[model samples]
Target: MAYSYYAYTPSHTAALVFAILFSITNAATVAQWIRYRAWVWLVMVVAGFMESLGYIVRTVSTKNPDKKGLFVAQFCLIVLAPVLMAAACYVIFGRIVYRVVPVESRTTKFLWVPPGFITTIFVTCDIVALLLQLGGAVLVSGTQPTQSNVQQRIQTGKNIALAGLAIQIACFGFFSIIALRFHFISKQFDKRLADKTTDETTEDEKYIMVNETQRKVLKNWRPLLRVINVACILILIRSIYRVCDFALGKSGYLEQHEWPAYVFDAAMMLPTLAIFVYWHPGKYLPYLGFRLPKSRRENL
Candidate 1:
C-alpha cells in the first residue's frame, strides 16, 4: 500500500536540469566508489542509486502528472534513501578522523569526551527515527483521508524525516570540526613525513584507507567535496522541502510556486552535476590504482 497522495507535475526546465545533474553525479560518485570500494561506499552506492532513481521518477512525474503511484513511489524512495547515504557518510567519518589524525594525538574525536561514542548515539537515534517514518507511511493507506489518524501518520512521517535531517546535519557539523583538525594534522604530518619521503611500498599500504585522499590533491576539495557536500545538502533539503510541498498541496498553493521546481532541478541538481563534470578524475587511477583497471583511466 502507498502512503503519499500528492501527484507532481514536471517542470520542463527543472527536470532537464535535474536529469543532467543526476546523470553527471551518478558517474562521479560511481567513480568514487569504484576506487574506495570500502563497505561504506557500497552502501553509499545503493543509497545514491535510489536517490538518482527518485530524480528520475520526478522526471516521470513531469510527463504524467496524474500518475499518483509514480509520484508516491518517487517521493518515498527519493526522500528516504539519501538519509541512509548520509548515514554511510557518517560512518566513513570516524575512520577518516582516526586515520588522518593519529589517535594518540587526536583531540577532535574525543574533544567532547565520549568522542565517536557520541556519534554512535546520534546514529542510533536517526535509525529509530527513519524506521518510524517508514512504518508510519504504511498506515497512511488504511486511514481515511481526512481522519485524524491519517493526519497524524503524515505528520509523524514528515517529523521523523525532519529529525533525521537535523541530526545528520549536526553530525556533519561535528565532522567538519574533526576535518578541520584533520587539516591541521595534515599540515603537521606533511612537515614530519615530508622529511622521510614517501615510498610506494611498505606497511602504509596495510592500514591506508582509500577514502582519505582528498578528491584530488592538486585540485583541492572545493569541487569534489562540494558535489558530495551538496549531495548531502540536497538530500537534507529535499526532506524539508517535501514537508512544505506536501503541506502546501493540502492548502492549494504548491502548483503556483515555481521556486520549488527551480530550486530542486536547477539550483540544486545542476551544480551537483557540474561537480562530477568538472572533477571526473579520468586521468588519475583510484583504489590503490589496482581495484580499477588501466583501461578505465584516460592517463594524466
Candidate 2:
C-alpha cells in the first residue's frame, strides 16, 4: 500500500515549543530592525519569519500527520530558511571588510564594487540553492500514490536538494578564505602602525601615535568580526549536518531521526540568529564609515 503520510511524525510538544520560540525571535528581530531602521536586516527578518511559520506548520503536521500539504510546506520552509540566513552572514563579511580592510590592503580596490559586491555573489548563490531545493520539494510533494514511485520521487528530490546545498557549502568555503585573508591583512596593518610609532614610547605621546583612531578602529573591529564569524561557523556546521542528512536518504539514521535534526539544525540555527539579534552590526558599523543608505540615514 502507498504511504499515507510521512514515515515519521514529529512530536507535537516539541514542535509547539520550537514554534513559540521562533515566533518570539522573529518578532524581536523585526522590532529591532524597525527601531534601528536597519533595512539590511530585511533578509534575516524574512528568514526568521519563515522559520516561525515552518515550526507552526510542523506543529500542525504533528496533529494531522497525514496532511501532506502541511508536511511539504513545513519541510520546504525550514529547508530554505537557512539559505537566507547564510546570505545575511555573507553580507556581514562585506560590511566588516569595508570597514576594517583598507582599500590599499585589499587585492584590488574595485574588487568589492557597488560596496557589497562580494556579499551579492553569495546572495546569488543562496538564491540558486533556494530555487533548487524548492523545486525539488514541489516535485516530491506531487509524487504518485504508488509506494515505489513515491519513494523514487522523494529520492530524486533529495538528490536535487543535495546538489543545491553543495553549491552553498562551496560558496561558504570560498568566503571563509577571503575572511581569513582580511584578518591577516589587518594584522599586517597593525604591525606597520606599531613600527612607525615605535619612537613615540612616552605615555603622554597622544599626537605622536600615528593613526591612533585607526588602531582603535581595528580594536573595535575584531570583537564584532569575531562574533559574526562564530555565527558563520554555526551556520556552516548546520549546513554540513543537513548535507549529511540528505546524503543518507530517507532510511538513513540522520534522516529518520528527529533528535538529530533538532540538535543539528534547529538548535544550531537558533543561536546563529540570536548572536545577530544581540550584536547587530548596524548600530556600531556607522562609526567606521559603513553607513546605512542615505534615505535610512535621515531617519537615524
Candidate 1: tens digits of C-alpha lDDT, residues 68-181: 666666656555664565565455444333323444544533444244453475457557656654554434322346575766766665565445455555555554454444
lDDT per residue (tens digit) for residues 1-300 in model 2: 434455566688988998999998888888878776677768899999999999999999888876778888898888889889888877777766655445554444434334446777888988998898788766765465666778878888888888888998888766666665566556655554344444434442211232342222222446556766687787789889989887887678985678887898889888877777777765556432334334221111
**Global lDDT for candidate 1?**
0.49
Candidate whose TM-score is highest: 2
How many clashing pairs per prediction, in order?
Answer: 1, 0
How high is the lDDT of residue 45 in model 1? Answer: 56
Reference-based TM-score of each model = 0.62, 0.80
User: RMSD for each model, in Å, please?
Assistant: 8.1, 6.0
Q: What is the lDDT of residue 288 in candidate 1?
A: 27
